[model samples]
Structures are given as structure tokens and as C-alpha cells.
Target chain A: NAGVTQTPKFRILKIGQSMTLQCTQDMNHNYMYWYRQDPGMGLKLIYYSVGAGITDKGEVPNGYNVSRSTTEDFPLRLELAAPSQTSVYFCASSSLAVYFTDTQYFGPGTRLTVL
Target chain B: GESVGLHLPTLSVQEGDNSIINCAYSNSASDYFIWYKQESGKGPQFIIDIRSNMDKRQGQRVTVLLNKTVKHLSLQIAATQPGDSAVYFCAEGPIDHGSSNTGKLIFGQGTTLQVKP
Candidate 1:
């Protein structure tokens, strides 16, 4: 089913520069999430969406923003990039029926380096 | 703040041997726990999960054991293969109500498993 897909496999941005990381899922999942993984560390939630037109901030949402205009798309926007934002960004999805404990299918990830 | 931590940063084992990875969580209210395997340059993938109601759950050659008494979580892999070499992370989630009920998970630092043939 191609599970989850993310574009711009790798990107590098200068300070204050902005870019969007695109994510798409064809599993018809009702929930979508964005997470960042630092070197030698686990992932930290950035933002998430319950469904179309519904989005909320996650653990580390200070430098990022997100919007869910459709069920298959959830894009993370960096308004003013900073060095702290340089990390591997991953997009994941899960079904609403089993969102509590279901497996969150992840994309290959978009590695962003902010210099 | 709740956190999940791995006991070891790296584990080396023979290909035919069994491997055990340990994790400790600070939140007693956490009901759901998951184990994820991440290969280099790739995102984390779910290996298995267990709820607070159960102490042990088995899947194929892997098994997850949860101990609420001491707040410990362990993942056991039998007859590990070279393909099993990856970073393993233990995540705690769905801790009670409110913000945690939103289905968020707190991941551990992760343990790198190296299987030697």
C-alpha cells in the first residue's frame, strides 16, 4: 500500500530560511504525526493531526507548524529555521480505531540540516 | 516529566544466541508500551507492544515482558540474525487521561543491537 511516503529525502537550510516537509499516507488513517530524531537519541513529537482540518502541537512544536487540509497530507512548516531544528524528520500514521496501541507506520524520513 | 530509558547503549550477541534488551520507565500510569527497531538511515518500525494488563506477549521469535511492580520492560529476540542488527527503542504511551490520552509516546534513548555471525 506504499504505507507512508515523505518527500525531499534530505535537505539543508540556512539560518532563518524556511521550507516545508511533505508527508502523504494512502492507508486512509485518521491520525498523522510528525517526529524528529536527534543523533543518538529517540524521536520527539513535533505535531499531529486527528483528521482533516484538525491539528495540534506536540512535545516540541516551538519551531514548527503544521496543517491538515486533507486526510492524506500533513505537512510540517518551518517558518524560521534554526540549528536546533536540524534533525531527521519522520512522518507516521495510525488508524483511529486502534490509535491507542496500534503500530504507527513511518516513512523513510526527511533528513534536514539547518546551518 | 515522564521518561523511558534503556539499560544499555549497545548489545553484541552471537547469531544463534538470544538477546535481551531492557528498559525502565518513570511513569507508573503508563498503560501501553512498545518496542521499535530502527535501521540506519531509516525510521523506527514497530516490533511488538504490550499493555499493563499483561505481563508477557509473544510474537514469532520475539517476546515482550512488562513488569509493573518495578516498572521495567524487556524485549527478547530468539536466534538473532544479522538482519536484527539495529537500534532498539522502548516507548511508553497512553498514560492515563488528558494530554496523554491523545496517543502520544515517549521514546527511550535506544539500544543498538549487533548480531555477530
Candidate 2:
């Protein structure tokens, strides 16, 4: 199985531009997450979904939106992208819940640069 | 914002030596803790994890220690190899809200481990 797959491996966005970072998992996991890692900083949670049709905000949900239309896909949308939004974006999924175990598997990552 | 942070910004160790990375979390209600290793140009990989009910857990070559009283967490790697060089992160999960099994995770800044030969 492809575990988790993320699209747009790298992208550069102009200020105020928008884009969507795609994520998909083949593990049939119920929990999906979107996180961004800045230079020398820890990964910050952007949005998460416990299951399809259910989504919620995380610590750094600003400038981002997520929709879980299906179990295999959870996409992150960035609106009016700013320089602050530039970072390495990673999508992850876990067989169990976030609290059940920290054994979430991750996608390669999408590197975004906002100019 | 919830602050789960690493005590050291970076660490350097010999290829065959052991390595220890420490983390400090502020939320006492956090019931779950995890350690992830992120290699260059790759996503974070689960190293090991420890629950609030347990003090330590061991994986293949990695171990996680959780001290709930002081909100401290640590990851130890024995016989570190070059592949072990990466950024290590410690994450915490609050017990309430969302669900007992599924909730948001608060990640620490991260400690970069450099394994030198």
C-alpha cells in the first residue's frame, strides 16, 4: 500500500495566491491530519479529521481549511497565502486515533514558498 | 498556544554512540506522548510512544520515556547510526475534547540530531 501520498511536491505561491495541498492514505485510517513545519520549528497542526465528513481546527488552523469528503482523502486549502504560510507541509494518517497511539504514518511532504 | 518543546536545539553524537533527546511539555492533562524522527526531505516517522499511564516504551532501537509529574519526555537511541541523524520531535495529546482515541496533537519545536562518523 502507498501508506500516504501527497501531491505538488514543491510549489511557490505569490502573496495572496491560493492553492490546495492534496493528501490521501491507503491504510483506510479514520484519522487524518495536516501539519506544517517551519525552519527550526516543530510541526504545527493545521487541521484534522477524525473521519469522513468530520473536520476540526488545530493549533495553527489560520489561513487554512480542510475537507474530508472521503476516507482516503483530506485536502488542505490555503487562502490568500502569505509569507508566514511558507513551510514544508506534511499529511499524515494513523490506523488509530491521535491519542490511541502516536504511530501516525506520513506522506513525503509538500514544500511551499510564498513570495 | 500549547507549548510542547525540546530542551536542546541540536545534538551531535558519534555514529556508534547513544543519543538522548529531551522534551518538556506544559499541559498536564496530556495523556499521550509520541516521538517522531524526520529525515531530510521526508515526513516525520514514528519512533516510539509512551502513554501517561506508562513511564517508558521501547522500540527496535529507540526508547521513549515519559515523566508526567514534571511534564518531561525523552527519546533514547542505542548504537546510533548515520541513518539516525535527523530532527526528532515530541508530541503531546490532550485527554479531553475530540475523542479519547482521536484528538489534536501538540508538537514540540524539535531537536536536530547529527550522527557523525
Candidate 3:
């Protein structure tokens, strides 16, 4: 299975440019998440969706937005990208079966560089 | 904000040795925990998990120990090898109710492990 897939393995953006990081999962998971990993810092949640059309903001939601138009896709949008937004972004999905104990499968990740 | 931070930033161990990475969490309400490994250019992959009810869980060559009373968690990798070199992260899930029933996870700053031959 492809588990989870993210497009544009690498990207670069100017200070004010905007772009969307596409994410998809063939696992048919109910929970999808977007997270960013900075240097020594671990993954920080950017946004998440419980199901199609249901999205919620996470710990580091500033300068970012997300949409879950379909079960197989949850794309993260960066607006007016700042150097602070330069980080490796990952997409994940889970069954949401037993609350927080479910295992999350991750995508390869997209490295974004903003100057 | 509630967060998880590692006790060490880096660790080096010889092959065939055991490695232990520790983490301290700020929130006691976190009942679920997970350990993830990330290679240089890859996303964090789930290794194992332990819940508050259980103090320990073992998988393949890794074991996770949780001390809820102290808000401490550790991941032990046995017979460490060069293939095990990567950044390890521990994550805690908040056990909140209402609109946050989803129980999102909070990740710690990772510990980089380097294994030598």
C-alpha cells in the first residue's frame, strides 16, 4: 500500500509567495494531519482533519491553512511564506479507532525553503 | 504550551551496544505516548507506543518504558547498529474531552543517535 503520499518532495519560495503541499492516503484513514519538523525540533502539528470536510487548527497553525475536500486528500497551504516556515513538512493519517493510541502512518515529507 | 523535550540532544554508541533515549513531558494528562525515528531526509516513522495503563511495551529490537508519575518516557534500542543512526522523538497525546476528543499529539525535540562500527 502507498500508505500516505505527499507531492513536491522539495520546494523553494520567496518571502510572500504562496503554495499548497498536497497530501493523499490510499489507506482510507479517518484522521489526517500536517506537521512541520524544524532542525532539532520535532514534528509540530500544523493542522488536521477528522474526516472529509472537517478540519481543525493545531499547535502551529499560524501562516498556514488546510483543506480536506476528500478522504484521500488533505493539503496544507502556506500564505506569505516566511523564513520561519522553512522546514520539512510531513503528512500522516490514522484510523482514529482508539483515541490517541492509534498508529499513525507518515508520508515521505516535503522540504520547504523560504528566503 | 505543553511540550516534550529530550534529556539529551545527541548520543553515540558502538555497534552491538544498547542505547537509551529519554524524554520529559510537561503535561501529566497525556495518557498516550509514541516513539518515532526519522532518517536524514525522511519523515518520522512510528516505532512503538505505550499507554498510561501499561508501563512498558516491546517491539522488534526496541522497547518503550513510561513513568506516568514522573512524566518521563524512554526508548531503548537494543544491539544498536549503523542502520539505527537517526533522530528519535517521543510524542505525547493529550487526553482531553469535548471538541478535542481527537487527542492530538505533541512531539519533543529529538535526540540524534549515532552508531559507530
Query: Pick by DockQ: which candidate is best?
Result: 2
lDDT of 3 by residue, B1-117 (tens): 687999999999999999999999989888889999999888889899998889999999999999878889999999999999999999888655554566578889899999999
Residues A40-101, candidate 2: write the lDDT tens digits: 88888888888999998887898999999999999999999999998999999977743355
- By DockQ, highest first, what's the ranking? 2, 3, 1
lDDT of 1 at B64: 99
lDDT of 3 by residue, A44-108 (tens): 88898889999999889999999998999999999999999999999999886544447788999
TM-score (chain B only), all candidates = 0.95, 0.92, 0.94
DockQ metric for all predictions: 0.51, 0.60, 0.58
Q: List the candidates' TM-scores in order.
A: 0.95, 0.93, 0.95
- List ranges where model 2 is wrong by over 4 Å: A97-102, B96-101
Candidate scoring better on lDDT of 1 and 2: 1
Q: Model 2 chain B, poorest ten-residue lDDT window?
A: B94-103
Please identify model 3 stretches exceeding 4 Å from their true place.
Answer: A98-100, B95-99
Q: What are the per-candidate TM-scores when only chain A is compared?
A: 0.96, 0.95, 0.96
Greater DockQ among 1 and 2 belongs to 2
